[model samples]
Target: MSAFVDTLRAEWTKFRTIRGWVIGTVAIVGVIVAFGLMPGMQGSCGKNGPGSECSLPVGPGGEEVTDTFTFLHQALTGDGEVIARVAGMTGIATGEDPDKPNHTVEPWAKAGLIIRAATDQGSSYAAVMVTGGHGVRMQYDYTHDVAGSPDGVTAAVPRWLRLTRAGDTVTAAESVDGDRWTTVGTARLRGLPPTVEVGLFATSPQHSEELHTGLMSGAMGGPTQVTGTFDHLAARDGWTGAAWHPDVIGHADGPANGAPGAEGPPAPASGVEQVGDAMRLTGSGDIAPAVSGSGGLGVSITQTLVGTFVGLILAVVVGTVFVTAEYRRGLVRTTFAASPGRLRVLAAKATVVGGVMFVTGLAAAAATVVFGQRVLRGNGVYVHSAPAGTEVRVVVGTAVLLAVAAILGLGLGALLRRGVTAVTTAVLVIVLPYLLAMTVLTGDAARWLLRVSPAAAFALQQASPEYPQVANLYTPADGYFPLAPWAGFAVLTAWAAVALAAAAVTQRRRDA
Candidate 1:
């Protein structure tokens, strides 16, 4: 053990004494911080002159959320229930021809029954709704979603939705006919007040389609409006309000509930109209988690770490040279003479390289995430907020990712015995795949590359989660990954471990 420590100390001394390696490591931090604070990265969020601040509503779980819709509601006191039959739903989307809009409904358009703590956006709420193409679903607090049925609604086959609140628990039920009901899902909204707003709501998120033209790709979308016809309205127990009130929550014309300037064109006027027992509601915008990409704010914290790829290249080159330089200079003889166990010498080199890169990456990533957010916000960009735990994982995982990559490069250096070849191979396998996945590929092709390649470790910097319930682009460019953060890290670590093992065997069997 003492000899191994001595070997590690010697390797550390050699690494520090090399002026080029020290400068290269320092370059990593410099590039990360420089790229993160780039002056060209500007936003129009709070640039609405003055008194217009950019912000997003925080949901019950403290996640940034979009809470915009049209509601026809009445006040409910104590335990109560609200029931409505969604007779029909329809919408329109933007088309290539400005004069001729496409008559269609977005897949995520929602019409439903909701019990909310207040009329204010981001307040606690539970809803059971029928989507345009998703059938029936129960969602709450802008995040949780539960599927109820796979059946669309029509005038002849209207879907009956019910929301019953008892204490803090809200139960959602759906029915084909008014008489037969199936319990869909239940949500517990802790701290729910005695009196809340019970309503029928209609909303549609921005409609977007991915546009691919050779290597260049973009999203084209526009504001969409959805109208829902509700009939068979009924209420039971502790209904207080005498008449239903109409409200366009998070109005598109104003800076409320959504990021400033995020609302493209003003949606068609949203309101509610009643004729006898039936009510028609028209609304636009989403009641879901805020994601990056089309219809979302600006970006996520991941944007600040764009320099990581460049930093990784430098780290790989340094790691490769650390081992291959010794072989090129015939210094391996001296290393093996001092520590006869070839595997021990290799281990010490890996530890020194990995530890140095880990510390460098940790400092760079931490500084970028912490101060870069302030820089982005100062530039009027609305970066989505992440949980403290998620932020912590991103910081630590980035360090681990860089450390493992350096170790992998070290192994490749030992195996190849040439710095230039090892660096090229490492970059091709690790960095090239990521660039192609982000710029050249799309959909499953891009996703598969990130899933299988060493570049998958980049998922560690993803601070935002992919929500199946939210209608947004879940692509690598948007910071969403096919694999979880730790799972992706594991893939890169496995590659490094295998490379190290192969190098060990080769070292024992062949000449130094």
Candidate 2:
């Protein structure tokens, strides 16, 4: 143990002194900080709520309500495609002026509503469409000719929408900047169900460059900023509102899908409303609701961070070079000579690499949160805060997985000896399963593949609602194989262990 510790110290010293390593660390930190500081690509909506006054009409059902309302009185609008599919539901469409032969716009498969404003020429348009269950849509087209100038035009005109819930309530509101909002009217909603999708969206219609576009260009062109805050809202229990509720929907899922015995309960009243899922508000309007839900932000960020780390380990220094260097330099003899005990040496290297990777992973994950949040915020992806403990687990678990990845690299390197062979093998291990799952898995097959993949282990970073069994994809209609987070991690750890054991046995009996 003492010798192992000493070797670890030596390895750490070697790591820090390497110019490449130092540069890499600094580069990572810099990227993280830069991402953290990026301003809103569109416009600042302020921290949390307390912005503009925009009103949302309640329906008649008394069963639905709008959780968030952002009003843009400035009238930055444009035309584009709309998304209208519920969870697991799929389809496609386009938005073009068929009558205008030369001016027809391409159809964009976006969630809902697109407000594009040309910053240069000051031309803009905002349009919203319904695509999901009980969807509604409204649009306002304005030109400087109407109000004289874009700025002055929005100031004089107030856009209003009447939202009627499932036959119980109605709400009306107006806005100037799409940020500050004011209620225009509110009536009890009527004749609606218990759940709905609520969020903001915008897109562009023109591919031409002759016009000057403002914040609307981004929203319309590719990634647009869509934001809204949920407050000053009232709801009737008899009807469901489009409020964000992690507890009610986060865990709402079915069985283990094709698992032999996994059988999930039926979907809840809302019928599985995820961020990207198309949702209907009031009676005829629809919303894609930015992909921001319960722990949706955290889950998305964590997934991205883990994926980044996986890419780094496979593409960057240590993971790529560990085994190859040993083979190329003929250092196997010396490595074995110094330790004599092959397994002990493997253990030592694994500890050192895993520890460093683990610590760095924590830093990377925290950076991911910071930068990811900034990106999400800039793009109007609401990043909700996670509970304290869950946040900690997210970081710790990510780091641990990183460490495992590194350890796996070290073990595989030792076993294969040829750095190229080992690195290739490692990359295959990390990437192959996901590819297979994407292409090969069907009903029951998905469970087995998902259970053993890194993707499955990473799912642990997700803070499952208290009742995850309610509405998640992992718990499908049939329940045969569903490994919990730690359980999945254990499976991965076992893989590492077996690999290490194999390396040890091979090293002891081989020529090196």
Model 1, global lDDT: 0.86
Stretches of candidate 1 above 4 Å error?
A: 94-102, 254-257, 275-277
Estimate, for each residue in 181-262, the C-alpha lDDT of model 1 and write its tens digit: 9999999999999989998999988776777788777777776778899998888876766788899898756532245555
- Number of clashing pairs per prediction, in order: 0, 109
For model 1, name the residue pairs that clash. none
Candidate models: Cα lDDT each: 0.86, 0.40
Q: What does candidate 2's lDDT look like per residue over 334-397, in tens digits? A: 7667656666666666776677667776786777765666675555433444556766786787
Q: Name the best candidate (by lDDT).
A: 1
- Supply candidate 2's per-residue lDDT for 380: 42
The positional error of residue 252 in candidate 1, measured at the CA in angstroms, is: 3.7
Output the lDDT of residue 303, model 1: 84
